[model samples]
Target: MTTPNNGDTVTIDYTLKRGDGEVVGSTQEVGPQQVQLGAGQTFPQIEQALTGMEVGENKVIAIDCANAFGPRNDQLVIDIPRANLPPEPAPQPGMALQAQQPDGTPMTLYVVEVGEEQIKADGNHPLAGEDITFDLTLRDIKQAA
Candidate 1:
């Protein structure tokens, strides 16, 4: 069996879980996910883990918070005036909002707290500060032609 190479397009079924074993996400429920190795399409650690994998191979890998989604950034949490938010939806805790970075790139923010005059939004990823485990099954690999 040929092992996956750096430029190969690999398909895998994966279940991602938190350190506490709570299911965070899974490809098993929605089918396999395809990734182009070395293309930065998936997590670097996951790609590294798949380096020597062959079709039908299964493995479990654990990644630290820093290597995965990264540690929570305190600087990303900000309080925005409620008047600045769109009036239609009425921002509430647990709501997701989009904002632009200083470089004009889009950033996602989660409403962490809603107050009478201000809304606290966190731009950190939902999974930030989490140690994740991935249960991976290599389903297919297409070598670069």
Candidate 2:
């Protein structure tokens, strides 16, 4: 049995859940995912957990909120004048908008409040400030060349 190591390509099936036990993401919906160990394609915590795991092994990894998505920042929630938003499609609560930061990096902002004069947007990840868990099954390993 081959064990996964850094640089190896591994196939894994995983179900992700929040601290509240809410099922947030799963490979069942998208199929097994291939991750390149140490390539930074996935979370570092996951890569660490996969190290030395043989095919067909199962493991559950827990990540705290700070290490998962980082803590939420109050400054990330900002209110913009309604006039600044595009008139088409009209901004609505729960809508996600693509915005460019001052540094030219793209950011995803979620609409939290739609007011008559101001629209509230939160730049934090939806899962920010929440602990997450990953139930993983190592399905296959392709040894690095």
Candidate 3:
């Protein structure tokens, strides 16, 4: 009956959903999520919710995009010349393409439209600007050193 406090390690199985009740993510499919309480590995809202839970506890969390991945930025979506794309992949609309930032971090861009000479790329997080709910269960809790 060890309850989670700050600095404890907690293992959880979670499912993420949209406000419309659509499933967004799940540990039941990808495996349970493991994190250290108060270690900043999760969203602040989520961490706050786990403050009092113990091993085997389960809870559902609802949060807005600002508390999740943050709001979407219109500027992140840009149009790039089609010629910039590799000739082999043959860019197509709706395709998820990997683009890089100036610092070399990889970004995911969806092909909004394939034009005669340009392709649209959006750098927003897929879950950005969307309100989401997370259903999380604590599978394990360990005390910190």
Task: Indicate which candidate wins on lDDT.
Answer: 2
Q: Please, what are the lDDT tens digits per residue for candidate 2 over residues 5-107? A: 8999999999999998899999989999999999999889999999978889999999999998999999999999989988989998999999999999999
Residue pairs of candidate 3 with colliding backbone atoms: none
Ranked candidates (TM-score, high to low): 2, 1, 3
* TM-score for all models, in order of appearance: 0.90, 0.92, 0.85
Which candidate achieves the best TM-score against the true structure?
2
Model 3 misses residue 30 by how many Å? Answer: 1.0
Candidate 2 Cα outliers beyond 4 Å, as residue runs: none
Write one digit per residue (lDDT tens) for candidate 1, span 1-145: 7989999999999999998999979996788999999999988888998989988999999999998899999999999999998887999888999999999999999999999999999999999999999999999998999
Instruction: Write model 3 residue lDDT over 59-137, tens digit each, in one string.
Output: 8999977877789899998999977888878888778998789999988998877888898887888888889998888
lDDT per model vs. reference: 0.93, 0.94, 0.85
* Candidate with better TM-score, 1 vs 3: 1
Please report, as a residue range, the 10-residue window in candidate 1 with the lowest summed lDDT. 24-33
Question: What is the lDDT, from 0 to 100, of the residue 131 in candidate 2?
Answer: 97
**Pairing residues by index, what is the TM-score of model 1?**
0.90
Candidate 2 versus the native: TM-score? 0.92
Ranking by lDDT: 2, 1, 3
